[model samples]
Target: MNLTLKIWRQKDANAKGGIVTYQLGGVEPDMSFLEMLDVLNQDLIDKGEEPVVFDHDCREGICGTCSLQINGEPHGPDRLITTCQLHMRMFKDGDTIVIEPFRAKAFPVIKDLIVDRSSFERIQQAGGYVSVNTSGNTQDANAILVPKDKADTAFDAATCIGCGACVAACKNASAMLFTSAKVSQLALLPQGEVEADRRVLAMVEQMDKEGFGNCTNTGACEIECPKGISLENIARMNREYLRASTK
Candidate 1:
């Protein structure tokens, strides 16, 4: 298949950027999106042209580093899919694909398709962890014996990969989904109980300090999230924040 790619190119965060066009020929329908990009970059390199730059790691979709806004949709038109997992077959021949980096003031564009998502790391550093002693191995997996329901919920919340798709897809660029997912995962587990209040407050404050926008319940973030992270997590975080604030 052939495709016309209109990709955003910027030298740096402060540099002026614009869409640069390139025509990709002979893209295999089954090729993963990043593989197609590799083909494109190879062609550009052969001609001594600067290759298109994009983020990718563990292309199987676990890393969440392959960030791209394709055809005006975060991670393309697919639901519950990362950019690396996106297949070229989703597009038809002669399609014009508009590619851009994940857009959010907090996530400044570094180059072609890469954005600095270290804001997430900073938020995590703020208090997204527990304080369990690890001097020795625990007794057994069944020792804690949390309710199955809570365990399941916590597992679901833990699936968040910090892709920043939630912020990019939000009208206000809210980091609520990402922050809440981290909170919910630990808050639901028995091990995360001791510092729950402090954790919520610290993470939320860090999120705000990162310049991320507020959540208005537009639900765009959940939809664009490659992991299907739910807005229910946002609601949970809100309740946690409210309770912490009152306390």
Candidate 2:
């Protein structure tokens, strides 16, 4: 199939950016979205032109690095999948696809379709870990029994891949969903109970410092999340924060 792609192009974070259009032909329906971009880049390179740059590590959707705003939706129109997992068959022949990077104050474009999502790392560092004794006498993790429901919920929350889609999909560019998922994963587990108050407090504070907007209950974040992380996590986080603050 032949297609038209209107992609964002920026030299760097400070550079002025705009959409550049190119015609891509012979796109196989089985090709993943990133593979389609790869074909486009190869054509440009063969013609002595600069290629469009995008972030991608693992193409199987495990890594959230392959992020793109396709036709105004994060990771395209597909549900529960990252850009790397999106297939070209989702589009029709002669379709004009608009591709852009995830936009947010905390996710400034580094170039082309790549944005600096290091803000997520900073938030995670603030308190997304459980302090554990890693000495030679470390206890087996399975020794601690967690309630089945709580364990399931925590596992669901832990599936967040930090793709910044929550921020991109929000009208306010809020990172609440992502932040809440991180908080919930640890807050629900006994291993993370000791620092629960401190973890919630620090993580929320760091999220604010990262310039992410507040959650307004619009629910866009959860809807756009590739992992389908629940809005319930946000409510849980709010409760955690309130309890932490009162203490």
Candidate 3:
């Protein structure tokens, strides 16, 4: 298939950026979106031009590193898939595709189609880990009993991949869905019960300091999330925060 791509190109964080157009032919329907981009880059390199830079790793959709805003959608027009998992067949022959990096004040552009999502790592580092050590004092899994339902919910919340799709989808650039998922995952578990209150408070405080906006409950984040992380996690986080504050 022949296609036209309008991609945003930036040399660095301070460089002036703009949409640059390119035309390509022979885009196979079976090619993954990143594979198609690879073809484009090869062509550019062959022409003595710099290849387009985009983030990608573990293209199987686990790492959540391949993030691109395709035609105004977080991970293209797909329901629950990262940019690397997106296929060329999602577009028709002769389609004009606009590919851009995820945009948020906290996500600064690094180069063509690559944005610095280290903000997420910072927020995670703030309070996303369990405080307990399990080196030699690890307990048997069967020693503690956890309700099936609560365990299921906690597992669901733990599916978040920190892809920044939530922030890109939100009109407010809110990290609430991602941050709240991390909070809820631990808050719902017995092992996490020890520092639950402090965890929520610190994570939320760090999220705010990252310059992320407030969640307006537009529900865009859950809709675009590749893992299908629920909006319910946000509600759970709010409840946890309230309980923490009251204590």
Candidate 4:
């Protein structure tokens, strides 16, 4: 396939940025979006022009580092698919593709397409983990069996990959869904009960500190999440936070 890419270019977070257009040809339908960008970059290199900068790791869609706003959609127009999982065939020949980075104050641009997502790390460090000390023959799973329903819910919540697609897709740039997923995952598990109250409070506080907007139930985050995590987790987080803050 042949195409034109209008990609955002910026030297750094402090620099002025604009959309720069380039032509791409001979793209394979099966090639992942990042791979197609690689071909474009190679072409730019051959012409002695600065190549487009983007992020990608573990291109199997596990890392969630492949962030891109393709034609006004996060990770392109695919459902439950990360940018790395997006294929060139999604576009038509001679199409003009608009590519941009995930925009949010919390995610300052580092270069062309990469952003400083350490804010997410800081939020995770706030309370995203269980404080349990497991060693020397940890208790058998059967010793403390949580309800199967609760376990399943917790597992589903735990599937969140922290991709920031939720933020990218939200008009308000909210991280509530992402933070809530982490909160709900632990809040539902027995091992996470010890810090449940404090965990919700801390994570919510950190999320707010990171300048993420509040969730107004527009549901854009759930729609664009590559993991297909639901807005239900956000509701769970709200309930947990309310109960925790009261106590």
Best-fitting candidate, measured by TM-score?
2
Report the C-alpha lDDT of model 2 over 27-119, residue by residue, as the tens digit: 999999999999999999999999999999989889888899999999999999999999999999999999999999999899999999999
- Candidate 1 lDDT, tens digit per residue, 1-247? 9899999989887888999999999999999999999999999999999998899989988987888989988899999999999999899999999999989989998887889999999999999998866679655657888998999999999999999989888889899999999999999998888999999999999999999999999999889999998899999999988998999
lDDT of 4: 0.91
**Inter-residue clash pairs, candidate 2:** none
Error of 3 at 230 (Å): 0.4
Report each candidate's C-alpha RMSD, comma-separated, in the order given: 1.2, 0.8, 1.0, 1.2
TM accuracy, model 1: 0.97
Off by over 4 Å in 4: 134-137
Error of 3 at 79 (Å): 0.9
Whole-structure CA lDDT of model 1: 0.92
Find the 10 residues in a row with the least total lDDT in model 1: 132-141
Q: What lDDT does the true structure give each of the candidates?
A: 0.92, 0.95, 0.92, 0.91
TM-score of each predicted structure versus truth: 0.97, 0.98, 0.98, 0.97
| Tens-digit per-residue lDDT, 1-247, candidate 3 | 9999999998888999999999999899999999999999999999999999999999999998989999999999999899999999899999999999999989989998998999888888888888756699977767778999999999999988999999999999999999999998888888889988888899899889989999999999999999999999999999999999999
**Could you tell which candidate, 3 or 4, scores higher by lDDT?**
3
